[model samples]
Target chain A: MGATIGRSIQCGGHRTLWASQGRSRETRQRAEAEGFEEVTALVDLCAQSDVIVSVCPPHAAAQLAEQVAGTGYGGVYVDANAIPPALAGRIGELIVGAGGGYVDGSIIGPPARASGSTRVYLSGTGAASVAELFDAGAADAVVLDGFFTSASALKMVYAAYTKGSAALLLSVLGGARSLRVDEALRLEWAMSIPELPARSDRLLEYSGRKAWRFEGEMRFISETFESAGLPGGFHSAAAEIYRRLGGQADESFPVAHEQTLTDLLAGAEPAPFDPTR
Target chain B: MGATIGRSIQCGGHRTLWASQGRSRETRQRAEAEGFEEVTALVDLCAQSDVIVSVCPPHAAAQLAEQVAGTGYGGVYVDANAIPPALAGRIGELIVGAGGGYVDGSIIGPPARASGSTRVYLSGTGAASVAELFDAGAADAVVLDGFFTSASALKMVYAAYTKGSAALLLSVLGGARSLRVDEALRLEWAMSIPELPARSDRLLEYSGRKAWRFEGEMRFISETFESAGLPGGFHSAAAEIYRRLGGQADESFPVAHEQTLTDLLAGAEPAPFDPTR
Candidate 1:
């Protein structure tokens, strides 16, 4: 996502700078290869760029926002990470307190590598300006007419069925495997509920390599639901399902290391519940 | 199920008697309507019928078997209920100790009201003999080559997904409703996962009136999975979802009292968990 945005900004005739202080060497190389100027010091990057976009795992969203805010940057800050509304609001306060304009952004589809499927939704007063930064036709960045947390809320709810259902399917299949009647259950499904056989296969294909990434997202989603006064047990269990299938290839498409539904249910251990995670 | 078996027995030129000692007036009337001769005493029913089939809720299966065994029933006893294997084994012991031949039977699909789509899987030494009682093509009563608990095990595992997935989807939608994102979530599912839009509708339709019946089945499935060393939280949570839906009209097809997904998540309160239930 970062590389896509960097290439888009370069195509729009704007200088793009990335702060690679604690990032991997591969990430630095990818940013450089995408025509992004690399700056080791956060202060230098903060001074050079007019706008900054933070895209990382949900757990790191708040810490990254704080690091960027601590640099006393007064530019527009866009957070395009999967996070809850309350957390986005808190991050909004962090960035706004440091005299920076805050824009809550969420990436709905896949990364804009070659285009066509991604929509970057933005909210807040700085949203339109931030959307224009990536308006190079590689991706669609739309400005929503709402406050800071609206984009985050949309993302959280959107994933409740998208990635959330994956966990539900995994839990049911895993439960069947544990009971030693998975094959019989599959046969029964084939006879009556014909949608499940194909749905499970599609879920496995789409989510196998991405399970590791979805763990934290599900955790944040659980928190979002619970904080809204709903039961979070499903997604809490879902996070554990993803955690069981830890450390994937970090790619959207399934690779050789990805596990199918049968292999996932058989190979991975059901991790014990830990709400703190 | 009992009605179908009674009809098949009568069609085969055999007499069928039902023990209606503690049954409701409506059930007795239904049995009479279905051509079953009603006996007010268990001993009388046990003496008259060569084969007795026990079909009830999972919670009452063991108690029903005990009651029949107390009458010193020497005939072949078929326990056809959704229950855990351990409970079935215990019931088998109770019947066998009382000099009665015991057959474990699991009814997959709906009640054998019509001819198609229902299977009666029977297991144990007397399974073949019990299968003979209802082999008149009304329903397929197959004798599985295994111990008494095998049939019950199959039923428990099959329902872990069939009914278990219903609970998962309900919990997710319920969570979204509580978070005030249900409409948004539904719209997203419609736009992205076209299958979920139809699947959610089907789940709501099938589970509306039968939520009361599935509560006990899910509980037994949870116990079966937990006994096999799997996490039982999903089914345990699912049981609560059904419990929230409360009692229904006890019909197979959708009627006037049925609740759609929108009505269910909106009208039904999220009941607190009670493991004792």
Candidate 2:
């Protein structure tokens, strides 16, 4: 995603520099091939670029923000990672205290591997300026008129449905398998909600390999809900489901051909059902 | 439902009788108006009818089956209610011990108010005979080839998604409201999942009035999942959500326009989120 966005910046007639501090050799080669200028130090990249966008794993968002803050580079810092709003607010504080302009941003849809498939939503005072930097790119950069943390909040709740429903379907199908009525339940779904069976298949195709990412993402989403005083048990369970699914390729992900997927989930069961009234 | 099924039985050219032991005056009047023979004594009704179909509330299914079995009713006794398979098996035992032919049945969809909206799914050896009772009716009585309890198993898992997803949306929407991003969350949902905004409102309309029923239904669903060695937390939380909603009308049900719903849910919070790193 970072490479693709950097290419988009270059297409918009701006010089894009990437810090090769801890990146892989393959990524460095790809960045160089994609018209990106790779720099050895984070400070050198910060000093040269007018905007620094952080797009990494959820767990690394804070660490990257802190590293940029330590450099004391007063550039427009856009943290476009999937983290809880409170954590984004904390990162905002970290950047502002270091005399850097902060923009809370979140990317929806997917990576800009193709045109019209992704969007970058930005919030905060510097959001419009940051959006302007990616004008007419592969992804649309839209500025939101809200507090700095609003973009992150939107991402958290939006994912609470997309990935959350996948976990819910997994739980539902597993429970049906355990009860020995999976086919009957699926038939009922077809009669009542015809979209669900296809939707489950779509989740398997798209979210199977991404389950590893969703594990941490759902944990942060759970925290986001808990911070607002709502029950976080659903997404917490979702995180556990994703943890069990891991990062298997889409083709290797278990489908409902037999009882394979449900059997895998059922093996992780804590106990047998209590038959008492 | 009873009236519609009774009319179907009468249309099938059979003597249909109903026991009015504890029924209301209005119900008795409606039973007579719908061509059902209303009997004043339970034993008399049990002795006269060729088959007795038990359709009542979830909590009352056991009691009614016990009452009929105590009368030594040797005819086909069909237990059709929304309950777990274990409870259905228990009711099957109660009827069979008294020399009665037991057929486990479950009704999906609404009551047979008109036509093409309800189905009565039946199982067990006597299911074929019981299905013959509703030869031509507003409701479709389809016999399933399985154990006496398979029909209820289907019902348990099927409702887990239909009503379960409704409760999940309520939690998601109410959480978004608490975080002060309800509109933003709705906008994102509209963009990504076009079905969700209307689906949420549909839940508020249908599930709200029926939440009182869903509270117990979700509890039984939780037990059903737990019996199958799956986690019961989702339906348990769903039961609590419905319990908090408590069967309000749509106008009185809390909406995103206010904070009334989230406040009630937040009251049941266990603990605030720990902000420690």
Candidate 3:
């Protein structure tokens, strides 16, 4: 997603710089394929760039922000990862406290490989300027007139359904399978919710491939729900669902639906509730 | 729902007998409107009926079954409530142990006011006979070729998503409202999931009215998930969501969406995790 976003910025005629010191070979290849200038050190990348967009897994967003903050380079910092609103706000404070401009951003839809397929929602102080960088590019950049954390809040809530419901459908299918009523449930759904059986099949095919990334995102969403004074258990359970499928992330092809269902059932031991997580 | 189902059975040219001694005035009126013969005592109703169908709140299913068992009514008993498969199995055992033919049944969809909109799934020993009772009636009756508990298991997984996703959407909307990004989130959803904003509104208006009933059903679903060797937290949290809105069950009309949101936010205290519940 980061490489694709960089490509979008480059399409707008801006020079995009990336630090590949600790990134995977695939990450380096993807970034290089997008023609992004690679800097060997984080400090060098920070010093050379006017704007730094952080797009990584939810777990890595804060650490990357801290690393950029440590370099003492005061530039427009865009945190475009999926994290809780409070975490986005804290990251904003970290960046602004270091004399840098902060923009809370979240990427919606898929990677911006085609026009109108994705949106980059920007909020906070430098949002407009960052939006300008994606002008007429593949990713439609929308500047939001709300607090800095609103972008992250929007992302959290948006995925709260799309991904959350996927996890839920998977869990339901798994439960039905465990109870030996999977076929009956499918036939019943066909008469009512006609879309569900196919949807469940698609979730089984695709979700496990990305479950590793989604596990952390679900936790962030759980925290986001808790911070907003709602129960966090939905996404917390979704995280457990994804964690069970996390092993399939490295598979070369989409794991067979039955295999994924077996994996899910094998990991059915309920995790102890931890409020502190 | 019970009265409606009775009406559907009556439409099939069967005499419907209902015990209205402990029922609410509205329930009695509904039953009378359906032309069901009212029996003053449950034992009398049990003694006169060839087959008894129990359709009540999920929490009351067990108690009602036990009461019927105590009557020593050696007739066909159909447990048609929204309950876990295991509970359905237990109820089936109690009925069969008392020298009665047990039919595991579950009504899916809404009250059977019209054909094709609702179905009553039946399994077990007297399932075919129970299905025959609804022949050419408002609710489509289908008998499964599996264990008796398959009917309840199907209902558990089916509602686990339909109602579970509704609770989730409400929570996400409430969370967005709490973060003061409700409008932004709605706008984003409009561009992505066009159905959500109005769906959330409908949920806020309608879900609260039936939340009291659904709260118990959600817990049953949670237990069903656990019994099927899956995490139960999704529906457990959904139960909490419905519990928050349980106050609206008695409203004269649909409560305003904002009031429902406020009600949800006000009851956001996290409940302790109870594995035993």
Candidate 4:
């Protein structure tokens, strides 16, 4: 996703640079194929770039922001990862405190391969400047009129439904399979909601490969919901669902649907009920 | 809904009877309008009917079955409500132990006002007979080839996503509203998922009026998930969401969208997180 974002930036007539000291060989190859200039050190990359976009997994967003801030390189820093608003605000503060412009940003779709397929939402003081970098690219840059964390807030709420509902469906399917009523459930779904069986099929096809990354994102969304004074248990459950499928992240082959159901049910015993929490 | 189901059964050329001793005047009026014959006592109703269909709230299902069982009803008992399979099985046992044939049943979709709008799924030894009662009627009856609780299990899993996702979207909308990013989130949704804004609107319109009943249903779904060794927190959270809106059940008119949002956010403080549960 980061390499594709860099490719979009380069498509907008901007020079994109990456510090690939610890990245995987596949990532290096992808970035190199996208014609990104590679820098050997983080400080060197931070010092040379006018605008830096961070697009990584949710767990790595803050640490990468802190590492970039520690270099004391003043530039527009875009943290475009799925994270809670409070964390996004703190990252913005960390960057701004270190003499750099911070733009709270979030990417909302697949990698920007074509127009209308992806959106880059930006807020904060440096939003317009960062938006300009994607003006001529496939990624649509949307500058929201609100506080800096609005971008991250939107991202959290958006994915809270899409990905959260997918996790709910997977759990439902797993439960039905466990109870030996899966076929009946599918028949009922076909009779009532005709779209769901296909949606569940797509989840089995795609979710396992992305579950590792989504687990962290679900946790972040849980925290986001908690911060907004709603129940966080929905995404917390979603995180558990993704965690069960996390092992399939490195299978190198498509997991069979039945195997995925088995993996989901392997250790998913419910916690004991407590009247007092 | 009970009255509508009675009307559908009557449409199939069967005489529908209800014991209205303690039922409210509104229910009595609805039952009378549906041309259902009213019996003055529970024991009298039990002796006269060949098949007793219990269509009530999830929480009331067991007690209703028990009440009818205490009358020594020997007819086929069909429990058509949203409840966990275990509870349905227990109810079936209670009925069967009382010399009654048990047919585990569940009703999906709205009340049986039209042919295609509702389904009555049945299982167990008496399923065929119960399905025959709804034939040539507005309610389409489907009998599954499995255990008695298969119908209830199908209902549990089906609703685990439909109503559960509605609760999730309500929470997401409430969170966005609380954080003041609702409009921006809607715009992002319009760009990515175009169907969501209208779906969220429909939730605000329809959910509050039915939330009082859905609360127990969500808890039943949570237990259903837990019994299957899956995480129950999704429906637990959904139960909380429904609990907050349960007050709307008695409202004389439709709730405004903004008012519903305010009601949802009211007293929704996050519980303190416990690392160990």
Chain B TM, per prediction: 0.86, 0.87, 0.95, 0.94
**lDDT of candidate 1 over B1-33, digit per residue (tens):** 667766766766778788888788888878889
Model 4 chain A: lowest-lDDT 10 consecutive positions:
A268-277
Error of 4 at A121 (Å): 0.8
Where in model 2 is the C-alpha error above 4 Å? A21-33, A41-48, A70-74, A113-116, A247-266, A269-277, B19-33, B40-50, B66-73, B113-116, B247-277
Model 3 regions lying over 4 Å from their true place = A269-277, B269-277
> What is residue A249's positional error in candidate 2, in angstroms?
4.7
Per-model chain A TM: 0.86, 0.88, 0.95, 0.95
CAPRI-wise, candidate 1 is: incorrect
Error of 3 at A165 (Å): 0.4
User: Which pairs clash in model 3?
Assistant: none
Which candidate, 2 or 4, would have the higher TM-score against the true structure?
Answer: 4
Over A87-189, each residue of candidate 4 has an lDDT whose tens digit, in order, gives: 8878888999999988988988887788899899998787998888887888888898878778888899989999999999999989888777889888878
Clashes of 2: 2
List model 3 lDDT by residue over A100-183, tens digit each: 888999999988878777999998777998999999689999988867777888899889989999999999989878877789
**Model 2 — TM-score against the truth?**
0.86
Residue-by-residue lDDT tens digits, candidate 2, B113-219: 65567778898787887888787777778787656688888888888877877777888877666655678777766766778988877665555666777788889
lDDT of each: 0.72, 0.77, 0.86, 0.87
> Positional deviation of B49 in candidate 2, in angstroms?
4.2
Residue A60, candidate 3: Cα error in Å is 0.9
